[model samples]
Target: MTQLSSNQFIRNLTIQDIDDCIILESKGFPPEQRCSPENCRYRLSVASNICLGLFETTPLGDSKLIGHILATKIATERITEAGMGKRIQGVENSGHFENSRNIGIHSVVIDPEYRGVHLGHIFLTKYIEYIRQLKLADKILIINKESLIPFYSKVGFENLGLTDCRFAGLIDYDMVYNL
Candidate 1:
């Protein structure tokens, strides 16, 4: 795998990244598990939390977004933003952690063509740092596939427990990280 240099640009996503973000998500996951356009838009517009995108400058000097990390408030605030869909409360157990105002890491996706690069880690590290800056959350909750456990573990996440989840009829596990 190639490592990203410290200078790589990872920042808050903007409206211009919508198509790239959606395309990257589709590359990483099935259609049913991907965030809808409206959800991505909401993440981009949320006040206290944010979604991030990874971009690399091309040889010609233009930059292209190739990865994203999506996060949102974990409690009643999430209820207001999401308006009752799957209600990830099961995966988001940290929502009530006294010292930590939880942030649900709803998705992380990289462009398939960019898979062998460490942009995913870069994206997560930046996202976590951003969350810490707000000091609103010291913990992050993730709902993910069992197969990705090793990857998340390497990034400081642990298996909080199992959850009865369904996505295109497939099951998943709930993972957490106390940042």
Candidate 2:
């Protein structure tokens, strides 16, 4: 239950949120770094329960998307292009897992207008708690660039050093948070 205001809250992101998410993706990531529309659709269609959206509801009853996180289950600690890039065969489509102890965080995007206020920190904290509550995995994993290492570290993800996988022409480091 993370909130920016009384009217702002978090919920599972669904297919209905694709357009809003795509817009936010563009604002949050470079052209080569953003997730594709097809991938977004598939993730939402198959695992929306594991994805989350932050929204603000106005007095007029209008709801606006503010930010979101995309994730999937992984069977191993091995980071691969299939999991981060290919999208289809890389991660599990199930919202939760029985044997897999890893949850692969695909993307996290906060609206530029909402950044600089530590909203990403708050949102990620809440997401971690939510997943823990669901018993989704024994640990969570993320592949992020060097510039983002400190940010993810602040949220408790331990850096596992540089990985061989390349995303959008940029090398990423492996990070983990044990449940």
Candidate 3:
């Protein structure tokens, strides 16, 4: 695999990226924490643009996806609604992706080999900029590992305390970044 560099570019994900994304997701997260393939496909099919990918150019003029951030938009009110609220546990099942004012950041993963280079920060910064440019949502929320609270804080996300939803059966915190 080609090493990622500063020349890396961020772009909207495409259908062709699903498989690679699933592979990376598997590698980056534990089985229970992994989003199902069906859900991954659903996100790509419905909200491809908001699903962002980080790619680096290869020596042979190809590009390889090294990281990705998947998110969906949902209304604040619907977040507390019955079935719709439960779907917030993961973006794939969220019924409000078609039209909503809040952006739920479902998952973010980087190639294990590329972990220490700050790619997560770079990807999130660009994603936030993109969201701001579109003005699609007033806030962005994420359920993440408690250990990562500091990491997300650096990106302007404020911790809202532990979430009721247990993704992968792990204790997770809900954090939000107001746009």
Q: Backbone collision count in every prediction? A: 0, 0, 0
Model 1: per-residue lDDT, tens digit, 1-179?
Answer: 34566445777787767778777778888888887876676666662236777887888888888788876656632222232133355564332223336667777888888776676776687677777787777567777788988888888888865645453555677787776
Q: What pairs collide in candidate 3?
A: none
Supply the global lDDT for candidate 1.
0.67
Error of 3 at 33 (Å): 0.6
- Which portions of model 2 show Cα errors greater than 4 Å? 1-3, 85-99
Which 10-residue window in model 3 sums to the lowest lDDT? 77-86
Q: Which stretches of candidate 1 lie over 4 Å from their true place?
A: 1-3, 76-100
lDDT scores for all predictions? 0.67, 0.82, 0.77
Better of 2 and 3 by TM-score: 2
Give the range where candidate 2 is weakest over 10 consecutive residues by summed lDDT: 89-98
> What are the TM-scores, per candidate, against the unseen true structure?
0.78, 0.89, 0.86
lDDT of 3 by residue, 38-142 (tens): 777867777787889998888898988899987666655222222123345655544445667787777799999878878888789878989899887788888
57-155 per-residue lDDT for model 2 (tens digits): 978999988889987676568555666533444455423333567888888989998788788998999999999999977888989999999999999
Ranking by TM-score: 2, 3, 1
Which residue pairs collide in model 2, if any? none
